[model samples]
Target: MSGENGNEEESRGLKSLRQLIRILSVKSGIDEAMADDLFDFLLTVDPEKGISDEEVEQIKGYKQADVRKVFRIFYDLRIASYRRGKHPDTGATRYYWYLDSRDADLALLRRKLQVLEKLKMRLKYEKENEFYVCPKDGARYTFDYAYEYQFTCPKCGTMLVPDDNSKYVKVLEDRISRLEEEIKKDERRVFGR
Candidate 1:
């Protein structure tokens, strides 16, 4: 029963995908076949938008890693925002990409919004977080009460200096701005507003 339901959902998703392809073809004045290619391209670029790597590879007549390589190529060309992250448990890096094309534009927006929220959380953590360092030796401290004593280091007592450069804050802010610009571009392309 569950398998049947899953198949039903998959069929519905494919139907909607075809409808989207037709609409995009009408909007962009492209042929149905070309629009279908574009739609499939978007799905392959961003699997989380209801496409899987295996499915994309099947459609493209390539291996899954080959699809990932294509995604990397597009990323290097600045065509899409490809994300690569390492799994903490397995230490294997996986890549996910986004194409701001019509079929999956909302996925890009949602990803940008998620990044913004994460940046906000990181900024809060950075603002509230404190760091301590030993003056004699350049030992670093990253917990509360790291330098509770005055002008002293736990390892080598000389004179402690607060290492609160907080350079990461600037980096995060820059990333947020870049994502915002990308989201704006996608919005403009989709809505022309």
Candidate 2:
């Protein structure tokens, strides 16, 4: 039924949002549990009347400082926004936070682009460089560095051998290809292009 389809779509959106929050948490060095809690709370907020961080702390039982930290990360990632307002009871300034769906999509796209660029750079380096590894210590070095050191392991005094990086190169290429396909699909979905 149409209702089932609607529910499916809603769940998919939530799943994507959760994944984005997890990524942001790792990148910002925040606790994933706290970020998930904050994200779930934000989902219940009315966009027109956003909820303040203090309210979130009171309702969610999270430390005010921790809530603020997560909110700051969300803001920095462009997944959330806040508006300044005065508390109705205290007549003091407060910030009410809410998620902007469009901004979240844009942020996701930007992140994907960044990852794609980094992967491409890594693939290029892997393809261009010849690597050497110490047979005993398992330490890896570039061809130039190994040659400079007389193709020996400094720590163990073991002769260095050529490292076969074809597998690694193939893995990078596959990842880059998959990520490129995903980005193209996301662009079509988000931008209708």
Candidate 3:
């Protein structure tokens, strides 16, 4: 039935959104428990009439400060948004928060692009540099640094040896290629191209 299909699609979207929140939380160094709680609470908010942080605290039994911190992180990531409004009873200004569905894909695409750029930069560095390693301490250094140190490990005083980084370079190149392909797919999906 069409209703069943719609429900399935909605569930899939929810799952994706949850995964995105988890990834963003880890990337931002937020506690996993807080992120999980925040994600669950956000799901209950009405998109059109967003919920206030105080309401979230009252309903979910979370500390207002902690809820605000998670909301602020989501706002920074463009996953959540808020609007200023006056409380009807108290006439006090309040921020009502809701998920920004329109910007979710854009935010994900932007994050992928950022990661792709970093991978490309690292690939370039790997290809251009000669590396040395300390066998005892497993410390790695660039040729210039190794030369300055007389090819000796600073921590353990072990002699440094040339590191064969061809395999590592290949791995980075592969990752870069895969990420580029994923970005292309996401762009097409997001832009309807």
Would you estimate the TM-scores of all the predictions? 0.41, 0.54, 0.53
Q: Which residue runs of candidate 3 sit more than 4 Å off their true CA positions?
A: 1-100
Cα lDDT of candidate 2 equals: 0.80
Candidate order, TM-score descending:
2, 3, 1
Report clash pairs, candidate 2.
Answer: none
Highest lDDT: give the candidate number: 2
**Model 3: per-residue Cα lDDT over 25-133, one tens digit each:** 7777777678777866675566679889899888888878878878988787677899999898999999999877556555456556666667777877888899999
Give the C-alpha miss distance for residue 21 in model 2, angstroms.
Answer: 14
lDDT of 3: 0.78
Note the Cα lDDT for every prediction shown. Answer: 0.59, 0.80, 0.78
lDDT of 1: 0.59
Top candidate by TM-score? 2
Give per-residue lDDT, candidate 2, residue 52. 89
How many residue pairs in model 1 have overlapping backbones?
Answer: 0
